[model samples]
Target: MNLRNKIAAGTLVLASATLMPFLGTWEGNGQNTVYADKLARGLPTVCKGITRHTSPYPVVVGDYWSNERCEEVERLVVQKGQLQLADCLTNQQIGQNTFDALSSHGHNFGYVSTCASRAVGLINAGRIAEGCKALAWAPDGKTPVWSYVTDEQGRKHFVPGLHARRRAEARLCSQ
Candidate 1:
């Protein structure tokens, strides 16, 4: 882990005893797949053909599979993820967008993982805007908060996909 992750993890360990209230699960007719796809990084496959599948776990992109197998993976991953978020947070009466955003983050990292810890703290503190913004920073924790970096040549490096997930989460949180 990086320095930021280490710090967040240490903080969560100290705060784990506290129980956060439950928020609703990811809502939508088909939203789960959308948020999950961002995390899945895999293509869906079935009947010896590849389509696109969004799963919480890693999968071989072009592997063939039965429809049942694909659904099972999605179900299990979502179930475990919900349980993890339920365990990690308290007093979470957040809206669909915010909740889904956080759930995505929790599912990707661990619910109690340091990165989550930071976002959790901000959310709980009622700094909704800050918290939402923090979600985008949760990945490596070193992603430039200002959205840019300086190279040795004194050249400015604009971070692109590095915080794309976080940006998506932040957008959801704002809604």
Candidate 2:
């Protein structure tokens, strides 16, 4: 089935497929490398941003994943993330672009956190445009929420890449 049909059917398989390139573009398909997540206080991450918490296999700092293993894990991780996000928005009637944007944002920040965000609250309140705007800003309406990455000292610094990603997500959501 096509992505639109699958989305209309309330299934996320095709949606996941459609969102894979978006995720890979942002996350980078580091299939064989396990690196420390500077944003997450040095959490070991591998294979398209799969951490120990997200991956089915162990995610040690020095570990290397085979291409097939990485592909399988990436698919599993994205599917799980989509499921979590879908469950959170079970009652909301949103479009494919909005769902894809939210899925991407949720994948990076976390589905639970995204669901509880001011953006989601606005969406639930039927203010979708405002919700899309809210995705790029904090409750104070000035700070870029997802643009900061934590350093080893636990200090947060703004990252242009993350800010750009948020902007892209907001644009997608607004569409």
Candidate 3:
């Protein structure tokens, strides 16, 4: 079924059908394992990037998640994220690809932050292509942003993985 049709069916439709595989590619389906998120200051994360903040259950360090439980929680979290993102968007008629891309961004960076970003401003102004490009670039349109992590020493360091993910998100948004 198409995205619009799925939307009409229920909120559960979009996350499971469209965004799951897209997110799985980037987030990595960790299956039954729980690990620390180094970038987020060692927050316990499990099953396709479910952290304590996003998880319905308390994320314990050694807890094991079954495949079914992981999928269920991921779907719930992604759907909640989609609703949060939709609330922040002024242009509700954006295409599925654009929405999915933005949802991915919202998933990684909080929806509130995504709402306040320059990319959202550009998209609201009806410059979608430029907005997509803005997801990966700074105001200079050359330097990349959102591709670094601050360490305990308060120093910012470049992360190749984040850079790649941002570029991939931009491509998805442009589509």
Candidate 4:
């Protein structure tokens, strides 16, 4: 083959290899799939024991049903994560661990938030550890688990139940 043809073939091979891992199915043990599965498991399909929920979409109060399956939840969560990631972090390559960690955060909250932007900036700047720490600092983008704000009635309002998730996301990012 000529030099031009060789270069073209090499580029095609590289592009295909890079995209294949994402496009291909996991069959059972993909990291992102497993991560998504674990994260979405605790979300209730029946909030307050009456209101029903569905995957890949938010829960509507009036439209409640209890027929959604577990596999459907996993698929929905993964699809949402992928879509969120695609929308926010476009045209850039990310490692599996980073992808999984960020996807977890995106799944829990959203990708187009202040926290996600900070994490993306840190990761893009090659400050992986700092980025991971930032993510742990603000899992929900607006509230860090360690923060406490005083309400108008002089009561301390705390954002509970997020520290653990933040820690988990940080752990995944560092890995």
Candidate 5:
């Protein structure tokens, strides 16, 4: 082989070695992942909930490790979910409650590992009994515990709304 051919061959070899771990031949044990997103171009279809996809193009000698290939994909997924949940929480659906944000924005899953939002979801789903029961097992316990400090008149106001009301009151008093 000429010098240029030898260099090209060496590069091909290096690329192949780098991509070996994610070549789609290695199977996952529900532990360390051997493949990135999908297993192969056409994974055999089976099971009730399994999904599959086909690769758009042939695997070259040196494809970069995709984000879907990392060992910490689960962690990354959780982090992404947390960010998403925060965005959802900040929206007007819950009145932008400060209690939710203070309580890790309902991502605590409590000490017993249950999402408080699930109970809330159930109530919204018209299964109040089930939702309350679910929250009873949550970290803070009590199916629908509201975060609060009593006002002068003792109305149970949502924390964020209370802050807004206080601000408005101050503005009015200043006027």
Candidate 6:
């Protein structure tokens, strides 16, 4: 092949590589994808705030996908993700941040799974005692709400003010 042909072929190869991440996905957040489809069916609310799929190729050619597009994939997905249920919030940074945020609000006790995770991460990160005392809002388990505990001692515990909120996680724990 001539120099021009060789360069063109190489460029095409690179371009295809960059496009691979966006190749098979849905269309939201300007081109989202379907992840954890089952989860979406079961829980639409959680997905409402997350966009599906992470781009192995999340570049914007002047605001479009192009070049080395992967570095920002985690940032864009996590910061601005509104995914569906069973959408695998694991890799999404937005998921992590959401979880961490809800968890970290020390005085409040009503948090879902994501919120709980965030709190624990922040607490542990801060070298705080992450236990029943970590939360000042937990009440007796009778209020139909509760904060979740790590299953370390073969028993579950709750914080003061989180009554009804714990109900959701309780059901999951039983199963």
**Positional deviation of residue 144's Cα in model 4 after best superposition, in angstroms:** 3.9
User: Measured by TM-score, how close is model 5 to the native structure?
Assistant: 0.21
Clashes of each: 8, 0, 0, 0, 1, 39
Clashing pairs in 2: none
Candidate 4 lDDT over residue span 47-160, tens digit each: 211112324455443343333433344555555444546455432444556556666566455546623567767876667777777776764545564324455567766544
**Largest TM-score belongs to which candidate?**
3
Can you give the TM-score per candidate against the true fold? 0.51, 0.84, 0.90, 0.51, 0.21, 0.20
Stretches of candidate 2 exceeding 4 Å from the true structure? 1-15, 139-142, 152-154
Ranking by lDDT: 3, 2, 1, 4, 5, 6
Instruction: Write the residue-wise lDDT of candidate 6 on 101-137 in tens digits.
Output: 2222211222234334432443335422332222333
* Per-model root-mean-square deviation over C-alphas: 11.2, 3.7, 3.5, 10.8, 22.9, 17.8
**Model 3 per-residue lDDT tens digits across residues 1-175:** 1234336655324574567788888788665678888987898988878998899898988789989999889989988888777666666446777788888888888788888899988987788898888889997988997789999999999888888988988998888
Candidate 5 residue pairs in backbone clash: 111-139
Assess each prediction's global lDDT (C-alpha) against the native.
0.48, 0.78, 0.80, 0.47, 0.30, 0.29
After superposing all C-alphas onto the true structure, candidate 1 shows an RMSD in angstroms of 11.2
lDDT of 5 by residue, 45-105 (tens): 2111012221222323223324444334323332333334333222122211221221222
Higher-TM-score candidate of 5 and 6: 5
Candidate 6 displacement at residue 137 in angstroms: 17
Residues 60-175, candidate 1: write the lDDT tens digits. Answer: 43444455664455455544554556555553444445655666666445456623567767776667677787776644656644335456567766656435645766787778
Q: Select the stronger candidate by lDDT from 1 and 2.
A: 2
